[model samples]
Target: MSKVTLAIGGMSCASCALSIEAEVKKIDGVLESSVNYATETAYFEISDDKLLDVIKSKVQSLGFSTSDELHTPTEKTSGENYLVKFYISIALSLLLFSLAMWPLMGWPNREVNWFIQLVLCLPIWAWIGLKFQKSLVRFFLTGKSNMNTLIGLGTTAAFVYSAIITVFNDASVSFGLTQKVYFEAVGFIISFVYLGNYFEERAKRKTKEALNSLFKLSSKKALVEIDSKFVEVDIDEVQKGSVLRVKPGEKFPVDGKILRGSSLIDESMITGEPVPLLKSSDDLVYSGTINGDSVIEYIATKVGKDTFLSQIIAFVEQAQGSRPKIQQFADRISSIFTPVVIAISVLTFICWFFLGPEPFWGNAISNMIAVLVIACPCALGLATPTAVVVATGRASLKGILIGGGEIIERSEKIDTIIFDKTGTITEGRPSVVEALFNNDEETTLMDIASIEQFSEHPLSNAIVKYSQDRKIPLSEPDSFEIVKGKGIIASIDEREYVIGNKLLLEESSIEFQQNLTPNEIGSYVFVACNGVHCATLVVGDKIKSTSKSVIDELKFLGIETWMITGDNEIVAEYVAKELGIEHFVANALPLEKSSYVESLQAKGKNVAMIGDGVNDAPALAKANVSMAMGTGADVAMNASDVTLVKGDLSKAIDFLKLSHGTMKIIKQNLFLSMVYNSLLIPIAAGVLVIFDGPMMPPVLASIAMGLSSISVVSNSLRIKTII
Candidate 1:
């Protein structure tokens, strides 16, 4: 399948996004599609790559704009200024309102005052309200409605009804018509809705501040070394394998490996670690990281869009554009909201006209306009996407890359968390703290190191490093077979040898002397030669300092924690106890780890798994939510839902806390919108008028509608501060 993301424009509410998504999905080859109103982007997948232009054209036909350059900030049209129009509309609205109320103020010439109100209200309705008028026209032509439709209908009704009363003033009185004209209501509704949209737009921009900050981190120029001479060039001009020079306090222009010199590098932008790390020759450096007070030369390994910083930006953009499950529920309601509201307005007009008090024609028209103005779908549409965008952006800043809103939803409900011991709860780097031998020590060390040199396991690297540090001579094994989750079997110099955990040795029927086994809290590797018990090597990895605190926090939150590892019972038990994890499973194979997660899930537990190796992939995929340490294997990160870039165990707590906080903000936004619409829609429809309560006027209804949407957007922005 092929995918495309288009930056969408002119979306007034969630219904606009839903309408575009619905139309885009009707195209052949389009498999899936989502349009995020908060992020103003559309994401879609297709069976064929050629469907790209077709989808864009389809969106244009629906009266919305699309851009293929999804990451670039959208610029406002050159001549479009809603704020300028708002100033004009509000000035005219205030003057018109005064003129319409002149007779009530005991002023003379009510007929002349009505004509003056008409001239003031015309410009506000026809000129300032042109955008909504166009949307209303599109609704008739295309049969799709949005927030603008309601605004257009409400203002037009009041404008036309008042214009008739003013033109036929004497005839209307003889026909028992009310002498009042609602030109002020027309002007105020347009002015207030414009003001609300202005604030909403400003608040929406704040939600993307994190993303904009990331864009600012990119280096624009690089000093490249050409023929032994440094030359300044555009960052995009620097190619992979080109040597580059970074001066003191300069940002690395591209991802590269240091070829000469050393420096203290600040990688806080990429890893969220505040401290600068010392780097020497042969250390890999990423683009957008600040170099400390030293000159360094490096060979660029990644450039342009392939840089580490670029990938993080892409990840953040994708996550922000994704819709969470709760947002889907909100979208469903918003899709039909405008049409249902129009139906209710019609019903309200018919009821009020037949049964309302004296001046029934006036009451019917006023209540109908009020209903149309007050039922805002914009608030309901914005409730969830805005929160998701802010939450995901904040998470990216903390070095946590959440996949999308779906992951955030899943994380909020996680009750049980299972962690892979190595590279997760403990420092994956192991070394030979102590080695015991039952036979010839030199020969055993040589054989084990030689066989382990062919293995890529963390334990194998530890043993290899130990032998190299001691200057111990080593030889390659002639033939070898790796036992998954256990050890390795090899033929060294025509001698059969086994090196692995106790289970591998015992399964091979090679019994070792129990008294020779070390009682230390570390992994034990038993060695057998020629079917005879030979030696035991103890490898130890330190528990991460943050592991205990994270575990404690999880327990305090009433979440169950468990540790699972392939390491022997001794090491697993020790790490589990040290970290205060009450439950653990040791001697688990890769599949066995997945089975344990499955068992928990079968018991109705919402489980989360954190791991950092290829062996941990199955279990990571099986859990309700999975976190991968960025310092671990690529396979593990690919299988997980959240990636902690610095591999800090504390980030796990950050993820859970962020999830809970984000969901809380979303719920608050939803409740605010739902309650505003439910309470006011009835009042606008004159439901309270039957009990002698005051009816909601169109001017007040427009104000309430605007505030409802502004409140939702403003509430979503609070997530950046709260989370």
Candidate 2:
């Protein structure tokens, strides 16, 4: 075994990398291969005399252009060049087609003279067949090939053999003999196949562009400072220890430290948190994050793929490139399908040639062509990929990012829906709702928020948020100190302040609020100042407005809903009852969530677990369908098959519905393709002549393909426009 490394381009996400790896590994003599997506390369170990060109062809066939080609040979790709070539090809093919049909358009039989037909079909096949012919030439030249080799040899053999016979003999048709013409089959196949793949390739390229565009958001140029004067230079031209100046409101182009000035930075682009963070001198800033408030300068520490934005892109690319289990089935089946069908066509021709005594050459040629045209996998090829791409695209717009086709299929039928409680179905933050002052007009509520802000706790954030929302003015408390075991203590305007639970108040020897409602399902904090009770802040966490609607919609769709949480049984029961969820496993541990999901699965139900980010990671990995929300933890995001980027629970069910619709479309397409084939294959094999009449295989093949392709495309188009 030896090592082989090939550069793999246009893989923007992990799934893309995985798909390429999967395709290459399918070939014989390929022992192992490792593809590094960030570097855009694949390394392989192979046996002697293995077919590298076939592997490259396989990659190209799966829609990702390989990087090993030294010249720009794939016509043109990605930009305006591609558009020009595509339009030109279409126009040339269409013109040639029209010219060939001109004489027949005015006829009663709509028929053409055989000589005229041969002349007309000449350019149509040659002009458009150049690509196929080129590949065919390369295959014979190198002895390395795959389907292209098969297509080239089979079609070229049929066409050239027929052309020679026509030129040599006046009688072009011979029964059980060496004379027959199949120029039409070899001529038209490549032209139409190219037409079928153009738009499909376009969509795939755009999906890659979306990732590239994200990476492109980083500034490619930087302002370098030398001798106190700023000089413009490309980011790659600058490196670590290079001083740079970043103007206020201008995006910092590189990951660096602040050399001069202080400013706030908006990191929402990477973190999804919109709050502008305060940064001072010597603080590090990430590339592409917005600088705010003041003019700031920094040193360029990192650039290019080393930048944070590039790292994020790399992770996404790697994940997308990892192939899913189901796609392997489709690819293996589809790749073999065409070859098998073509073989049957050859066999059908051979049988007819030997068995029929007074055989007709046209009839035998038609049967072979029938097999080629009828066996086309335009429908089978489109069946899974079309719906998968569409469903995944549609799901993305609705906040759910499905990983692959298998996930899409699983999402189509959801039986038990499990939701994580905090952050997912309820407001995770607590707030002060009621503040009471007894026998004092000292602004007790205001003083409590002032002290509470000094502490770092979820309960404190709740109170702070509430007080700020109420427009309460808080003073910086003097002599601020946190009582380790109890709470925080501070002196506001020379007056001592304390905020915490009952223990802190007791330690302060102050009266405190008691009998706090347990069913309140929220953390609480108290306030005291100058050794006397100032106010009691009732902290409460509210349910998200969207949660109710999400649940209601799911119920309306007849989906069974459940809520599982580590929160107390009382709190869990209260929230579940409010949302009208009947099945709940409250106070369950993180592992228990998966256990509960497994229990549902034990009953033969397809379970979808909806969870808060990190806490639900395990359960998400366990469920048949895992949907993680925007607010979820990074672990949850990675674990779940479907990630709701918007954190909209309503889209959870909507995405399910979208998958269901996509599956329905897939089923419909398969049914139509099979039904059409069942009728056409038999008829093209001359099965229906005894009953009805005879039909041309070429015309029938074109019709079968046109119908299948147009319907698949039309149905898949629904995904693009879907919400």
Scored by TM-score, the top model is 2
Residue by residue across 50-134, what tens digits does model 1's lDDT show? Answer: 8998998898888888887644553443113667787899899889867755676777587788788888888888899887787
Residue range with the least summed lDDT across 10 consecutive positions in model 1: 71-80
lDDT of 2 by residue, 1-723 (tens): 676556566443344465567668888888886665433567677885466777778777755567663212222253343344445555554543454345457642222333444564465456654554555564445333333434555456555554555454444444333432444444444444454344334434333433454445578788898787989998788777888888878888888888787766876444322225668778888887888767888887887778766665554444434433343233344335545555677776776566533455655665776555555444654566666766776666666777666576777778779988876787554555455666453477677777778765556667777778879888777677865435687777777777777788887788754433222444456666678766666665467788888888888888899998776677688888888887777667555676788788889988898876444655776677788777655556655677778777777767777777777777776676566655665565655555666544344555565677678767777766546
- The worst-scoring run of ten residues by lDDT in candidate 2 lies at 69-78
Q: Give the TM-score of candidate 1.
A: 0.54
For each candidate in turn, the TM-score is: 0.54, 0.60
How high is the CA lDDT of each candidate model? 0.77, 0.62
lDDT of 1 at 13: 63
